[model samples]
Target chain A: MSEFGSNSENGGRVLSFEREEKCHSAGCLELVVQGKATHYHGPRNVDSLLRAMGENSLYANVRINGDVLDRRDFENVSIKTDDTIDILYFMGGGACST
Target chain B: MFDLTDEEILRYSRHIILSEVGGTGQQKLKEARVLVVGAGGLGSPVLLYLAAAGVGRIGVIEDDVVDVTNLQRQVIHATADVDKPKVHSASETMKQINPLIEVDVYHERLTRDNIFPLLENYDIVVDGVDNFPTRYLINDACVMKKKFLVEGGILRFMGLIMSINGGETACYRCVFEEPPPPGTVPSCAEAGILGAVAGVVGTLQATEVLKIITGVGEPLFNRLLQFDAEGLRFHEVNARRNPKCPVCGENPTITELIEYAYTCETQAPGSS
Candidate 1:
């Protein structure tokens, strides 16, 4: 996920093409950009978007499509056809406080 | 009991004629309490229409004294009222408009300590306020108390309106997420607003309040309506409640109130 690749996860578009450019002090996430093809862009999409983002993780827990994935779920989640995903930024934990 | 005499009904004949707002609605107007924050550009119309619509107990909150420049857009105040306390002048005008209604004036700045208590007494809260800090504060208070909020804002030629039913509808935080860092946006005093633009937004806010009170018409919940007077166009975008929203999300983060100091030191350097 270093640069643009014809990964089936991104339809035909490029995925994870840049280097992390420090976003904040917290840290960054390695993203894999799933361009036009798969239209799947998430925290795990691009390495640079992730690197730039640092440790500022988007999702404390998430599920690709319908599969529930928590903090440990980011690496194994596979991209499929017509699956829309959002790399929502979650601070502290996934649960709401107020 | 605020009785409506035949003369009063006659005076409000048009409003009373609507099936949605007959005597019962009129009576609700008499009983309902609304607190309008800010007495400036947007506040002027909100106050004017809410008062005219016969909202029973209307409270106008403002600490700003009237200024000569405000007259161009703040219709509630007159040229002679310049330098007069806005709360005093606005309340005076409301009483003149409808002596039957109760007009409580708060000639004090809206601060965090007072926001919660002040909002608690009102049935509906109208955000005719300009700055983001007060707007966010108002939103938080309303959500926490489950009060209906009618919010309207105008910048230059554009404006936005949202009806927050607290937990029932998308709040102001649901859309923008955060305010534009400070000094990113200019105020009316600096950027300049077409007087009518504020009137339009304020009037729309007043209408939303009436509908919420009278339970009539489609309220602008879950939607952000924008009006661009210069382009003569109106646009509406659907706003969904962010499941992760800090204030109104499914998993809320902001359990208590947090105050963000909002003021602009730059004098229209970035006006408009």
Candidate 2:
């Protein structure tokens, strides 16, 4: 049911997004990449990693080492072995008026 | 310099008793002015705590009317106040908590033209807003104005809080860069936030604000504090100031406020 149903595993770890009902995708629930955890070395390209984790939807913002990965570069972007990747998103519902 | 009355001394005795926040620190609080940009969930706790801490002048802006649904987490409002403007309703509660402090209420929306003049009077600004556009707007404004800003947000069981000393520290834009395109991220209404999650983040924002006012402790500057209520754990992200950040970077690009046309709840293009 995931948009990216690739077979290769992702290289970086994931954060609170796995099984996070609000998260965009599934299949990467077991990987914990918050702060400094373990790193999977399968795919370096962000697109490939996201595809492998099934979180490849363009909607989710990919953050690598603190910078927001440009949407145009997701396909070819490379993640270094020491890089930290966080799949982040947000909600709009505080005072609601701002 | 404003002096704390005998009654205020008794009321904030616990705070004044602390070596870090003695009479001197309490006096600083009395002279500090803070602006809170929202009256909903996160704003609720920020308002309550700041008011209770005896912040001299507290200004709140919101063009929203309270709704029944808000009762779940917007603790500052009651069922009876559902039809009332959020600012008025929240201000009343704040006054009841402490009649000594002044609560300035603005029942208007914050716009690019008005943000500067509005923020000019306050020493610190707190972002308890819900939407991303407003979040980025507040950050950009504070960074440009060189005012301290305490930013917090909640979605589901996750919450993020960070403090920015205007251009000196890592701003919201420095960490998140730009608001994710609308429809890409879910809204609290759709994503479902735990009511207490807002409390957790809002209270933290209030703490950061007080810390800024009294200069007592280290604020969350250059650090993004992430909270997971479900797991009851906290995560800290190093929010370093980036030279390439469009807003606070060396050669800034976002010279003016930018408002996204759509809210977060907007459905992505054609997706069902």
Candidate 3:
């Protein structure tokens, strides 16, 4: 398993299951993750998505679809497929107010 | 209600015609007092747009003289202004843009001792500074004074903006926590910014200021807006006020202004 709990052994099972459900929902929601199109299997919460995006810092804010996800929901709120996840780092290069 | 002369009506006809910024908004703009911190890249567009919008009292604090290289992005300074005090050049341009508005010039650098007194008189503070030390200083000061601040920064082809309404919104420290270790990040001079990128960010800062002054639109409070000019992508990220924030938190650790060590190597002669 990778640090973020991606199990190599379960990869095949996850893909097979996802493929089987692909016909039902057209690949189970495509995520525009971090400014890129991504395909994720099953429903993932905001925290997992953030970890997948290599965001280890808690100073980040996650947006689901078009709404901002509260910090309390990062671990519990499920993000469906086709949802857009924007993980923005709020630091660096702020010479003024930004 | 402000008594608008016939000339004033014609001068701001476009703004006066807009339903959002009618005569009432124009009056608010005329009564607003805004302070812009820098006169370089980001400060240039911010000062120009705010002046053109006819902000009544605009205070600019800049200690540097105009250099030939600053002309690329510091549009407020002209070719003839080279070597002239940037504050003078900026004030002259602002007056030329709108003779009705008053421009106050502070030909000195902002420091811990002077920041509070200088900022107390302004309704809103617009930060266009180019260094991290001053950025943090301004943030802490604004937080303590309970003032609204419009913050922006630009480097290369990317820019970021945020607005903080005292302790109510997410202050700069709430996001960055603390400035990066000195020498860890490159300065604008070292990284070399695209001149036009500064214009994009500074113009947006001015827009935020106008929104704050007139209450026309929802400012970027508790949110961060980042733009990548290269790909033409914009992202708005929600930010939360940290209860553990050193300066603006419930159990705040920082009660006074603390000046961070300056690491910029290209200092003017005699500057400490």
**Which ranges of candidate 1 are over 4 A from the true structure?**
A1-98, B1-3, B265-272
- Residue A66 error for model 1, in Å? 19
Q: TM-score for each prediction?
A: 0.72, 0.85, 0.78
How high is the DockQ of candidate 2?
0.22
Q: lDDT rank, highest first?
A: 2, 3, 1
Residues B1-272 of candidate 3: C-alpha lDDT, one tens digit per residue:
66777888999999999999999999999999998988888888999999999899999987889999888888888999999999899899989989999999999888899999998789898888777677888999999999999988776566789999987899988766777545544556555677788888889999999989888989999988887666566766667787878899899998999877666545321110
Worst 10 residues of 1 chain B by lDDT: B263-272
Model 2 spans with C-alpha error above 4 angstroms: A1-32, A39-42, A51-68, A80-82, A91-98, B263-272
Ranking by DockQ: 2, 3, 1
True contacts kept of each: 0.00, 0.28, 0.08
lDDT of 3 by residue, A2-51 (tens): 12222223332111111211213433555665445545544367776556
Q: By DockQ, is 2 or 3 better?
A: 2
TM-score of 2: 0.85
Candidate 1 local lDDT, B134-196, one digit each (tens): 777788888888899987877666677889898778887776555544544556665568888
Q: Which stretches of candidate 3 lie over 4 Å from their true place?
A: A1-98, B265-272
* True-structure RMSD for candidate 2: 6.3
